[model samples]
Target chain A: MRWLRLGALLLVVGFLLGTAVWLRPFGSPTAFEMDDYFLKNAQVEAGANNVVTSVVFDYRGFDTLGEATVLLCAVVGVAFILRRVKP
Target chain B: MSVVVRTIARLLLPWVLAFGGYVIMHGHLTPGGGFQGGAVVASAVALVVIAFGAEGLKGQKNLFSFLEDLGAIAFVALAFLGIGSTFFRNVLAGGGGLFGTPVPFGPNPGWLNTGGTLPLMNWAVGLKVLAGLGSVVLLLALFGGKEDG
Candidate 1:
């Protein structure tokens, strides 16, 4: 069992190191066409100076909605669990 | 916890709140947005809780819950506003009305009166996050207590 664990750990480390060595260079992405479009047009279309906010609240508003829903659910769960019970 | 800690928290409360408001208000123009701002404000709540106690926020749980509900409703309503074109559409952008200023292409000083629905949504989400997180903390702190506090 000990030998098995050591071999598994070595395999994982070796795989991670190999992948890291072949990683892409910084500041360059494999696909940036969509990003370029957002950078250029987010301000004009969304009318927001911050492109990240435009993407979050305008282009991907549904995701924010979903996130809000999740937060609501979480709060509800906490409140329910923590509710005081009458004797 | 102590007098000094409580005093510091009291002094810092307004500044933290102001910074959080700034983040939410300038979500369209700056790096911080609704979620970040809301988290900032919620941190203020936590600071208060730590300095004082869970009982310090006694009787305020319902208010937080109500605010969270209001924020959720406002966010949905804002989304429905753009349903004429499409859900979450930028219908109010460049409309020359409230928060409807057209932004000039390329980088410049950011205008506040732009990103119509975006800013509204930012406010909505900010409220939701602050209330939600603050209430969560309050609930956890007050849990299993003698009373609701």
Candidate 2:
């Protein structure tokens, strides 16, 4: 039973790792490069000094907002959990 | 509470804060930014809390909360500025610079406060990080110990 569980866990991990390796979101483009687009538009559109910040905040502001929301949710979750326990 | 450790922490804390400030301000030109510098400053606070105990940071929880709120509000406000002109726009309304100077020249392509919302963002983040991390650690320290019933 323990061996079966271990094998199943290993199989799942292997499948997930293989999927991640095969699918690269930031991979090189076949035709046009995304970095060029980001660099060119970031300065004019975002008006940010840092390209990375522009990418994080302006170019993908919606995504960044979602990320911030995730952080907020995590903080709230921790607070809720801690509150339930006696101090 | 060892005297040597306390003395060392005292000596190092101010420098850490100053360097963190420098990193936050010069984030536009340099590699380090608001989050990195903020974490660095927070780590200094953590050091103080660890070496001196939670009592060292006592009575400052309110202040920390204020800083955290300020940072969050500033960030959100900057984002909302997009509704008018552009998101995170450098809309300083004219009088803008370090210590209210027009423009303090630094290196090329940017100034000390060249990045408009960027510096404000840095300040906000610094406060948030220092406060947020300090509070979390202090809370843990307060509740994690084996208290006599």
Candidate 3:
């Protein structure tokens, strides 16, 4: 049984290695049109020097909103779980 | 826990809180942002829990919940400000009111008064994250199967 588990683990690791080897090199973009646009106009359009913040909070804001909601839900759930029951 | 640990925590607390504030405030110009800054502050709160225990925490959980709701509401309201054009629009940018300074193209020092709705959103998210994470830490410390020292 132990050997079977070890064999499975090895198979999974091998698959992951093959996938990683097949993946494209880092820092190489397939297209630059969007990147070019953001670089050229983020400051003027978003009116912020930090393009990353503008992108996170402005360009992709709904995602951030969703993230905030998730966090809120998690906090609420934890609070509920920790609350003492009258029973 | 011990006197030495407690003393060190006391000394480090203010600096942690200040650094978190800096990250949130400088979200538009630096590497950190509302969520990141809030997490930093929350870590300080956790440190307090570990060093002093939940009994040492002053505020109630209800207060933290209220602050969390307030942050969420304010963030949504700010997002709606952009609805005049589209959702999440930068309505305040270049408008010369609040956070509306127009920034020139290229690298510069980056103004605090710029970024229109960005700063407002950052504040909202920062508040939400701070309260949310702080509440989580407080609750865990309160009910973690170990009595407060």
Candidate 4:
């Protein structure tokens, strides 16, 4: 059983390695149209020096909203799961 | 908890909270933003839980949930502030109002009052994350308790 578990772990590791090797080189993207546009215009348009912040909270505000919703649900889930546990 | 653990938590709690506040407030000016800052604050809460146990957190779950809801609602409301142009349209940029200062064309010391609705949104996210994570961990700790605190 131990050997079987080791073999399974090795298979998972090999698959992960293969997937990593199949990906493109680091720091190089195939498409820069949108990225360039954001980089160029994010400052003046978003009025924030941090381009990433502008993208997250302005250009991609909907995504951030969704993230907040997700966090809410997570807290709710934990509360519900432990609802019966009295402190 | 051990005395050393309690002492360390007491010493570190204020610093942790201050760091979190800095990250949240400097979202537009620095590397860390709302979510990152919220996580930092949540970690501080966790340290308190670890040192003091969840006994003190009793009855606080509702407060956390309420604050989380408030954050979520505030974020959505702020997003709606741009309904005049379009959703998420930076209406405040260059308007010279709340978070509406025009940014220079390049890198400079960023202003706090310059992110339009972005800073408000960052604050909303920070509050949400802090409350959400703190409550979740507190509940889990309560569940794992071998006896009531």
Instruction: Name the top DockQ candidate.
Output: 1
Instruction: Give Cα-based local distance difference scores for all models.
Output: 0.91, 0.66, 0.89, 0.86
Query: For every candidate, how close is chain A to the native chain A in TM-score?
Result: 0.79, 0.58, 0.85, 0.78
Model 1 per-residue lDDT tens digits across residues B16-50: 99999999999888899999999999999999899
Any residue pairs clashing in model 4, and if so which? none
lDDT of 3 by residue, B1-149 (tens): 99988999999999999999999999998899999999999999999998988886856677777889889999999989878789888899988988888988999987899999998888899989999999999988887664432
Over 4 Å off, model 2:
A16-34, A44-48, A62-87, B85-110
- Point out the worst 10-residue segment of candidate 3 chain A by lDDT: A78-87
Residue B20's lDDT in candidate 4: 98
Per-prediction TM-score: 0.93, 0.75, 0.94, 0.90
Q: After superposition, how far is residue A62 of candidate 3 from its true place, in Å?
A: 0.7
**Candidate 3: which docking quality band?**
medium
Residue-level lDDT of model 4, residues B39-137, one tens digit each, is 999999899899999889888877887888888888888888789988877777789988888887888876888978877878888999999888878
DockQ sort, best first? 1, 3, 4, 2
- Give the total clashing residue pairs for model 3: 0
Interface RMSD of 4: 2.8
Question: What are the per-model DockQ values?
Answer: 0.68, 0.23, 0.65, 0.63
For candidate 2, write residues B1-149 as lDDT tens digits: 69998999989989999998888877755778777888888888788887898876768768877887887777788778667865654454234453222432222465454454555666666666666766677666655566611
User: What residue pairs clash in candidate 3, if any at all?
Assistant: none
Instruction: In angstroms, give how far residue A73 of model 2 lies from its true place.
Output: 4.8
| lDDT rank order | 1, 3, 4, 2
Which candidate would rank higher by TM-score, 1 or 3? Answer: 3
Question: Model 3 fnat?
Answer: 0.78
Clashing pairs in 2: none
